[model samples]
Target: MEGHPPGLETVTLPPYSPELQPVERAWNLTDEPLANRCFESLAEL
Candidate 1:
């Protein structure tokens, strides 16, 4: 509730909500720089 620590907010989400996950939101940002780019191997990447 409103009594939570200062500047902190609590959120609750349904179990199946993929859009709310951090990684789900980060994919586009991470993918944009790598689009059409290639590395010789996994280690290079």
Candidate 2:
């Protein structure tokens, strides 16, 4: 996977366009590892 990790797990956002808004790229970068993750309280998080 070190060769290219994005091909497997990348959650591709909208079609990347240089002409788009200031948001360079928008994707849930923390979706997998953070999935089903919770804290008993806000302080715990």
Candidate 3:
């Protein structure tokens, strides 16, 4: 079940697995820089 052209690769995920989703990991990291910081307004944020 593993075949792809040269260096190309494929990924598969099962249904309803938020913990395994890559987007969740990205969101977790995105919050880091804004964690302890305060914003002047919504526009500043």
Residue-level lDDT tens digits of model 2 in 1-45: 366656575445568654464453434564666679987988876
Model 3 lDDT on a 0 to 1 scale: 0.82
For model 3 the local lDDT of residue 12 reads 80
Return the clash pairs for model 3, or none: none
lDDT of 1: 0.87
Please give the distance, in angstroms, between residue 28's alpha carbon in candidate 2 and its true position after superposition: 3.9
Query: By lDDT, who's the top model here?
Result: 1
Q: Which window of 10 residues has the lowest lDDT sum in candidate 3? A: 1-10
Q: Each candidate: RMSD to true structure?
A: 5.9, 11.6, 6.3
Which segments of model 2 are wrong by more than 4 Å? 1-33
Q: Can you tell me which runs of candidate 3 are displaced by over 4 Å? A: 1-19
Model 2 has an lDDT value of 0.60
For every model shown, the clashing-pair count is 0, 0, 0
Worst 10 residues of 2 by lDDT: 18-27
